[model samples]
Target: MRFVAMCSAPAPLDQAAIRVRHTLMLLALLWDADRARVDLAHELRLSRSATGNIVNELLAAGLVQEVGQREDGSVGRRATLLRLKACAAALLAVDLGASHARMDLLDLRCRTLGTRTVAHDITRGPGATYSLLAGLLEQLLLETRIDRSQIALLGIGVPGPVDHDTGCVVQPPNMPGWDSENIAAELGRLVALPVLVDNDANLGALAESRFGAHAGLSDLIYIKVATGIGAGILLGGQLHRGVRGGAGEIGHISINEQGPVGRSGNPGSLESYAAAQVVPALAAQLRATGLQTRLPDPASLQDLLTHAAHDPLARAVWETTGHHVGVAVSTVLNLFNPQAVVIGGRLALAGEVFLDAVRASAVGRTMHINAARAHIALGTLGAEVGVLGAGAMMVDHLLTPRGLPLLYSIARRAGQPVAEATPLAQDAASRAPPAVSAVYTPHPSPPRSHPYSPRRNT
Candidate 1:
């Protein structure tokens, strides 16, 4: 996900301190951990009194609720467990690809309520794309019977390099006319929600880490080999967007300095060799060399895959492409040494032929230590991975101090204000040192026991 700075207000230091504690508490509860009050206090390095104050505010705001008492067979009194109120609010997640878009309405816990996909050309520029997304969102809301006011945030994953903080897209080679466009401002006008924009590949990485077959892999790399190729990287369970958000443009990695030029003016870039769009042409070129094949001259990627089961030429082209991908992945393995590398997007559909080739090439090239630990696998989240990732990012932001205002605004519009101050919180105005530092440095969360299994709407 992208990083957004916490919004500072001209409020009293005590209030700011309380807000920080509240944000940290929410994060501790949201990470699929079954925690009690004392557990939260311990994890956040806060006093029990301060933890109770934050919990009270969250409970009043209807963002969190006590489920039941924990029963760990401890000798002491059973501590009551807390969980984020799943139905407190919902988020709108959008995945914008080079030629299609998918949207999902997700609850606070990232359960999909409604989903929709539509084919559209992203090259039409920001305005047209925004209009189309707005329409799709309207359709999704109507189908789900969700009110506009219930949507707490909008998270969109675009197929481009995004300035995560500004919500602006950089000069993405795949997305023409999207350079320096502030997608959040443009899309916010139509959706009327706080918008978060991030790279689609990064979202893929986030989704895979949280919900794919390789769920719980903190240090992972998700490579999206679609119309364009790029990578999403995670380090210590956190997204590494790098400085200026240009960290994962693997498609521009040059394999042949004198090979064909890509849109980015990079010669023999990985995209030129391994992207889904290039597969058909690669097959055609191989066929021109008098190779026997039943497929037509101008076969689509789908057609090639369908014929690949028995077509030697089709298999050859995929293997070659996979080799190119493996070359780049080898470089990734050496540098990042991630725990796993997940391959997603259209080209991943080639199945074993593609994956096996990638594995062979990558494993053969990288250091044995790095290669041995890294698991090369396919993404199980399918077409909705990007949307899921967008939703996950939104949920994460909503639990933070900066994003709490957006949720609070939604709550106010719904006529739910913060709960009245209690006797325990009467001394909130007291000037005292915070129990913990303002900076939150959370320990890496463990993998969820039950990862999300995506359900498609009938």
Candidate 2:
């Protein structure tokens, strides 16, 4: 869900051409519809002649098309409207959670062409899970009548720590027997597509930033509270994976030294105190305290939620859990001072009762200046956020300057690498003579001294 901006010192004409193409792709994606030539020129800060030339190149490549003309009120002649050919390529996206998997086939615009969800367990090990995934993908492709050759990329999100460079699971405490499994490699082999993998929370944050409530925000955090708890952090408009891709592991953060040990062997961790696994225990304690009766002890988080509507005790338990969540989030707000905090996952399904408590506690515990600048809200994407995020991740990668050639090579060779792909990309760039003078200027890097000022929500 995170993107690393490509930055380099002065480069050759070929490299500059790649940057121009990258900028055009970004503009097309953001515009989402036909845009006039003048608007494109203004947005990219390129001269009209340069914009026209680049647009012509894109038109020749079949990546973009002229969709008639825009009759503006200006005295000048009508302007041609250009839009991205969203259906020119497709991507496969998967969301692998602790107890279920969701797969989707999406077009370049991240629109779902087909999708399937199955209940499965990660505890069954990588082999079983992957086999299921392969079968589901095959079925989805068949159902959608999408040619395998058209699938340009695959993106997956897992509920565990991922070695970002290798796409391997690294000792995920919740997913037994998943350690060291190179999921991307296995999945790539099964589908013969270039694959990318990332943490589910991170993907959720990315999805939110691009398509959900926080779209266009530069600083935000997404907290997932479900079978476990994790945070997806976005700072200065990019994902912040720590040294080991464990930046937002708020669930494992020690909240109380004297608290019970969790699966990670961490005592009094946030997950140990407030995750779904503790719901039954909380229900039992409430029952033992002779509070208003619920059938028997709540067997699951769902039971707790179902009872909360009528049982005061169940509501109190949710409030208490929410407060713990709020405390953890308050710490996050103080440190990152993000513009918004999105609460998601199964726990969030409990609705406003849970979110209200979290908001109250977080605001009360944080500095007024920090709390005042932040807005905490339930995730708008609901259960589909992870899958949507996976799609967005692939779109982000494939549209990049370097990724464009890789995408073409994959399509040409059924996901096999073409040794001359880079050269092909350079050749394409070289053909755009008008862009030779349109140097790509990277976005200015944020200052390193203090927290960034909150960006206005778009």
Candidate 3:
């Protein structure tokens, strides 16, 4: 999966308030039975005074409460425990993919209440996808019984390139008729809630970094090699999204100049060769058409992958695709030199043959430091990752609130506009040590560039 970011005009905020709120939410995610206020202060690297102010604000908002004290097992007063009020608010997460769309309801503790999924060919068109998504959303809303007023925020993850400003599919290959549309805004009118949109691959990466497999790894790559190909990059704990929404468009990297044109047309793009988009049909041809392959007619992605593990023709196809994957991933490894590359998606089911081939080729082509330092491994999150990532996105948007109320879930509650917000510097300083991001080092997010099919290759 790829992690692409869009450039947007900064939202006005009460910087101090946002910081406190954001820090509290992060603490909530990191909180557990061993929770302690001092630990919170230490983990966030905030001064006692600053952490106190934040905790107080959350307490006043009725979002948090002091549960009890932690026994230090030493000759010291017990430290008080703080945690989220389970019923504080609700969130909605949407995952729109090539084959299916789902909506989930989550509480403050990151518990899922209700989920609804629909099986529709989203790639046929965007309008249809929207309608189907709307229906599932309605069902989720009804099933969860969450009032529009109780809904805190909405987070959406979609396949293909995302338009940062509009929050829709910019140039998805499988899904058609989604270009330059503000899907978040359109769905807002139907549900009336605040919404945040991001590419699925990017969300997958963030999910891993925040709560999934790649957690605690500051710099890592999460690659999705299913119906499509993309990568998600996490640097210093924050997701690395490019200026435009196509930063990790690894699938479009042409492997051979003279090969078949890809979905996004860069000739021999990774998806064109690696994705399951063509595998089922190809499997059918080989099995039904009596093309002389050892493997019988394999229908699903699993079937192909299983066959490839032993079938000669399937093995050849997998090896060929692995070469392309290594060619593309080696560049990323060389450039970023992340400590790990976690590969996922339907195609990843092809297993050891694909992984071994890609790894061998990548090791041969890339710097020894890059190859040796970063372990190329399969993700353990599996198929549910997209939905889980979508949930994380929702939690993120809720935690990092801006002053202005967004247009995502229009029928949802109104957050005070960001224009009248204040910064965290207004709070008194604390003596506590800070965490890694306390200084907030900046990475340049590029301009809003679209990933369109260029008239010709460079």
Best by lDDT: 1
Q: Sort the candidates on TM-score, descending order.
A: 2, 1, 3
Global lDDT of model 3: 0.62
lDDT of each: 0.74, 0.72, 0.62
TM-score of candidate 2 to 2 decimals: 0.85
Q: Best candidate, TM-score-wise?
A: 2
Candidate 2 has an lDDT of 0.72
lDDT of 2 by residue, 171-220 (tens): 89888998998887887887787788888999888878766756767788
Model 2, residue 245: what's the lDDT? 77
Give the residue spans of candidate 2 off by over 4 A: 1-33, 71-76, 294-296, 408-458
Q: Could you tell me which 10 consecutive residues in candidate 2 have the lowest summed lDDT?
A: 432-441
Model 3 regions lying over 4 Å from their true place: 1-34, 38-54, 75-77, 280-294, 298-300, 306-313, 401-458
| lDDT at residue 449 of model 3 (Cα atoms) | 26
Q: Ranking under lDDT, best-scoring first?
A: 1, 2, 3
Query: lDDT score, residue 221, model 1?
Result: 95
Q: TM-score for model 3? A: 0.77
TM-score of each: 0.83, 0.85, 0.77
